[model samples]
Target: MKKTDIILLTGLIGSIIFSNFAGFEKKLDKIEHEVLRMHILANSDTEYDQNLKLKVRDKLLENSDEIFGGCENLEEMKIRANEKLDEINDIVLDVIHANGYNYTAQTQLVNMEFDAREYGDITMPAGKYDALRVTIGEAEGHNWWCVMYPPLCIPAAEKVESDEQAAEDYFEAEELDIMKNPDKYEVRFKCVELFRGLKEKLSK
Candidate 1:
C-alpha cells in the first residue's frame, strides 16, 4: 500500500473509532485477528479454493500438540509457537500457492523489519512478534485480521526483518465492515488510483 493511501484509510478508521467506541474492543479484536491470517493468505499466493485453505488451517490448529510438544506456560508455549509459526506459515503458503495465486509469503513478525501496508511505508522492529498477529486476508473473503502473538512471526528475527506496527491503526471491524467484504470506500478508491498512477509511472 502507498503512503497517501494509508492516510486516507486513517481517516476512514478514525470515523469508526469515534462513532463506535462503545463496541470498539471486540470489534477491533476481530479485525486484528482476521488481518493476520489474511496477510498470510494474501502474500501466500496459494490455491484459490477456499475449502482447501480451511482444511489446512484446521489441521494446523488441531495438531498443535503433535506439532509442538507440551509447554507449561506462556513463555514456553511462546517458544514452541515461534518455531511452529514458520512451519504454519510455510504450510499456508503451500496451500495457497498450490491452489493458484501470485503472492510472496513473508513471515517476518517483528515490527521494525515491516513495511507499512497503509502508511509510512516504514519497516518495523526486529524481535519476537509479541504484540500482534496481523494477517492481510482471511480465508472467508476480502478482509484482514489482527491479534497478539501469532506463532509464525514470533521468533525468526535471524531470518527476517522487523514487523511491528506495519499497518494503520484500524477502526472497529463493524464500522469498516472489513470482516466481511469491505465496501469500496475512499480507501479502495485511492488504492485503485495508486495502481493507476504506478502504471502511468511505469509507462513513462
Candidate 2:
C-alpha cells in the first residue's frame, strides 16, 4: 500500500478500536453504578479459618432478607444496609462465637475496586463498585464476594430459581448479554482493566 493509504488505514483502525473501548467502558460504568457487591474477607488461610469463613457466609445468607428487605434500588439497599451495619456485625459475631472463634468482624460500606469475577453463570467485569465489606480478624486471607443487590448468591433468599434469573430482572438485555458471554468481550475487558490500573497508578 502507498504511504498515505497506510497512514489512513492505521488511523481508521485506531478509531474503530477506540470506539469499541468507549462503548464497553460506558456499559461497564452503568453496571458498576447500578450494582452493590458483598465482600467478606477471612481472618486467615488456615483450614479452620476458611471453614469459619464459609460458616460466616452461610449466616449472612440466611439473614439476607433482613439485611436487604424492602429495598427498591441501589440507593435504598445502600441505606438499608448502612442502617443495619450494627445488626450485620452482630450476625457476624454470632457466627464467629458459635463457631468457637473469637475473631472480631467489622462491617462497613465502601467503594472498592474488584477484579473480573465469575459467579455461577454470570461474569462481572472488573471495576470499582460500592460494596458492603466484612473484615474478620486480620483479614489477610482470600475473600468471598458476590452481587449483593441482585441477590445472586442467595437465590433462595430472593425466591428465584437461579442467580441468572435474579440477574435478568435487574440487568438490561445488552448488559446481560455482555455478562453471560464473557468470551466475546474478554479482550475488551482486559483492555479496560489495564487502562484503569494505569490510570489509578498515575492518579496515585
Candidate 3:
C-alpha cells in the first residue's frame, strides 16, 4: 500500500475506536446521573448474618426518612448521607451487638454497576450508580440493594405519592416509562446490562 493510504487507514481506525469509547463513557455518565442507589452487604451467607443485614437495612431506612424526604437530587442526598454516616454506623453497630454478633460495619459512598433490578412495580435499568455501600464484616455474602434517593425502599403505601412526585421531578418521560414498566423495554435493558458488564470489566 502507498504510505499516504496506510496513514489514512490507520487514522480512520483510531477515530472509530475513539468514537465508540466516548459514546460508551457518555452512556455510563448518563446512567449514573439518573439514579442514586444503596447496597448492604452481610458478613456471610448464613441465615443469622443475612437477617442481621436486613435489620441494619430496616433501621437505616427508618432513620433516613427525613433525609430522603427532603433531598431533591442525588448530590443533596449524597451530602446528607455523608453528614449522617456516623449515625448510620452507630445504627449498624447497635443492630450487630443486639443480635449478639461480633462484627464490624463499614460504610462508604461509591460508584457501582447493577443489572436490572425490580422493586414492586418499578424496575431500575442496568447501569452505574452512585451508592451508599454498607458492608458488614467479611462482606462476602449476598447483599440487599434499593434506590435510596427516590425513596423506593420505603413502604409501598407510604411512598407512593412521594415516589410519583420524585419521578415527575427527577426523571425524563422516557426514563420514567422504562422504570415503571421495564419489561416493555426488554431489548434495551439487556443491552444496558451487557454494556454495564463491559464497563465494569474495563474499569477493573
Candidate 4:
C-alpha cells in the first residue's frame, strides 16, 4: 500500500481508539487473538519485482481456496497455512521462473505487530496479529498485506462481498457498533485524530 493510503486508513483507526477508549483493551484482546494477516514483500523496489510480488500474491490467493476454506478458527488457520508453506513456495517459484526471473520465495508463520489495517469498510486495530509472511528474494520492496483467515481482501480481489461481517467476527456487539457507526462519537474521534497527528509530527 502507498503511504497516503496508510495514513487515511490509520486515521480511521485513530478515530476508533479515541472514541472507544472505555472498552478498547477488551476489544484489543479479541483482535490480537483472532485476526490473521498475510504480508508479501517484493525482491526490490523496482517495478518488475513489485509486479512479480503481486503475481505471486494472486497465485497464492487462487490456490488458497482449499486451505482457507477448511479452517474455522485462528489455530486451525495457522496449522493449515503452515502446512502449505512448501506448496506456497512452489507456486511462487513457478511464477518467478515463468516470468524469466531468478528470485526465490520463502514463507513462514509468525506472530507480529501490525498497524491499523483497513479492508473496505472494516478496520483492524493496531496490535499483534498472527501472519504468514512471504518474502521474495531480498524482500525490500513496498509490501502488500491483507487479512488472510477471514478472507477479507480475497473476496474483494475476486469481486465478491469481501467479508462484510469481519468486524462482527472480531469484535463484541458494542465495539462493532462503535466501529460501524463512528459518526455517533464524533467528539472522541476528533480528539483522537488531533492527538495522533501531533504525535506523528513530534516523532518526525
Candidate 5:
C-alpha cells in the first residue's frame, strides 16, 4: 500500500471512532439529564444497621407516590423533592425511631458521581447524576440506589420487558437502544466514562 493511501485510511478510521464516541457521549448526557436517582446510605455495615437501612428504604418506597407523584419531568421531580425535603427527613427519622434507633437522617438534593449500575435488564452508564441523597447517622455503611423519576423503584410501577420499553416515553429510540443493548456499546460506554472522569477531575 502507498504511504499516502495508508495515512488516508488511518485518518478515516480515526474519524469513525471519534464520531461513535461523540454520539455515545450525547446519548449519555441525555440519559443523565432525564433521570433522577435515589441514594440511601446506612449508618454502618453491621447486620442490624443494614437491616435498619432497608426499613428506612421500605418507608421511603412506601411513600414514593407522595414524594414523586404529579411530577412530569426531571425538573418537576427535583422541585417537588426540594419542596418536600423536610417531610422526607421526617419520614426517615420516624422510621429510624420506630425501629429502635437514634440515628439521624439527612435528605438533600445533590449532583454526584455514580458508577455504572444494572437494574434488572437495564444498564445505566457511569456518570454524574442528580440524586436525592439520604445519609443516615454516620453514613459509614454500604448504600443503595435506584432510578426515581421514571418510577423504576416503585413496587406498583409498570413492569417492562426491556429498557427500551421501560423508558420509551422519556428517551429517544437511539438512546434507549444503547441502554437496551449495553453489550453492543460496551467499549463506547467505557470511553465515555473515561472522558467524563477526566473532565470531572480537571474541573475539581
Candidate 6:
C-alpha cells in the first residue's frame, strides 16, 4: 500500500481527525492544532507541557507529509503519530531522573516522583507523578478505545495492515493547500470552529 494509504484501526480514523484536528479548525489548521494538542496532552500535564504540545503539534502539521508519509501501515501510522510524543517522553525522563526522581515502571506507568525542594521548584506535590496517556494505535474517543491499564493501551485491528518500508520523518516538511483540497467543505467548516475558539479564548 502507498504510504498515504496507511489506515488506522477501522474506527479510529475519525477520532484521529476530530481530536487531532481539534474538530473546529480549518483543514490545514485542524491538522496543525491536533498535532500540537498531542504534544501538549502527552506531557506530564503542566502549563508548559500543554503549551509545548500546541507548538509541537503545529510543527508536525507543517510537515504533515513527513508525519503522514511515515505511516505506511498500522504500526507505522502509530509510530508516525507518536514521533514527537516519544521524543518528549525521553526528555522528561532525563530531567526528572537527573533530579533524583524515581523512574519506577510500576504497572507500566513509569512513576517519576521527586522532592520539589531538590529541584528548587514549587506548587508541586510531594507525591509520585508520571506522564499519563492513551497509548498509540489505541485512542477510541466516544467509541471503543480498547483496554485501559495504566497510561498505555492496546490497538484494536480488524486485519493487520501491511508492513511499512520506512520510519517516520522528524524535520522534513511540506504542505498541501487545504483550499484546493479534496475535502474543501470539511475544511471550511472546521476553520470556523478554530476561529471561534480563538475568539472565545482571546475575549476571555
Top candidate (TM-score): 2
Error (Å) of candidate 6 at residue 200 is 21
* Best-to-worst ranking by TM-score: 2, 5, 4, 3, 1, 6
Q: Model 4: how far is 115 from its true place, Å?
A: 1.4
C-alpha positional error of residue 21 in candidate 6 after TM-score superposition, expressed in Å: 17
Q: What is the C-alpha lDDT of each candidate?
A: 0.41, 0.88, 0.76, 0.76, 0.85, 0.33
Per-prediction TM-score to the true structure, in the order listed = 0.32, 0.88, 0.72, 0.73, 0.87, 0.21
Q: Give the lowest summed-lDDT range of ten residues in model 5.
A: 155-164
Per-residue alpha-carbon lDDT of candidate 3 for residues 114-195, written as tens digits (9 for 90 to 100): 7777766566766668899999999999999987766566744356455556556666775677678767767655554666
Backbone clashes (count) for model 4: 0
lDDT of 5 by residue, 38-81 (tens): 99999999999999988888899989887778887788999999
lDDT of 6 by residue, 1-204 (tens): 655555655347867766655543433332332221121233344444444334433343344454345344443544444555454445444443544544321112233332221111101112233322322111221111111111011111212221110101211121222322324445544555565568789999
Pairs that collide in candidate 5 are none
Q: For candidate 4, lDDT tens digit of each residue in 49-118?
A: 9899899889888888766676877788898888888887888899999999998789889888776666
Q: Give Cα distance to truth, residue 53, candidate 6, Å.
A: 9.3
Weakest lDDT window of 10 consecutive positions for candidate 4: 21-30
Runs off by more than 4 Å, candidate 1 = 1-56, 109-204
Cα deviation in Å at residue 154, candidate 2?
Answer: 1.5
TM-score of 4: 0.73
Off by over 4 Å in 4: 1-22, 163-171, 178-204
Give one digit per residue, the lDDT tens place, for model 2 in 1-204.
Answer: 999999999999999998888888899999999989989999999999988988888889988887788787889999999899999999999999998888899999999988888877789887889999999999999998878887677884445578788889999999999989989988988888777778789999
- Once fitted onto the true fold, the runs of candidate 6 whose alpha carbons sit more than 4 angstroms away are 1-38, 41-91, 99-175, 179-187, 190-204
Clashing pairs in 4: none
Ranking by lDDT: 2, 5, 3, 4, 1, 6
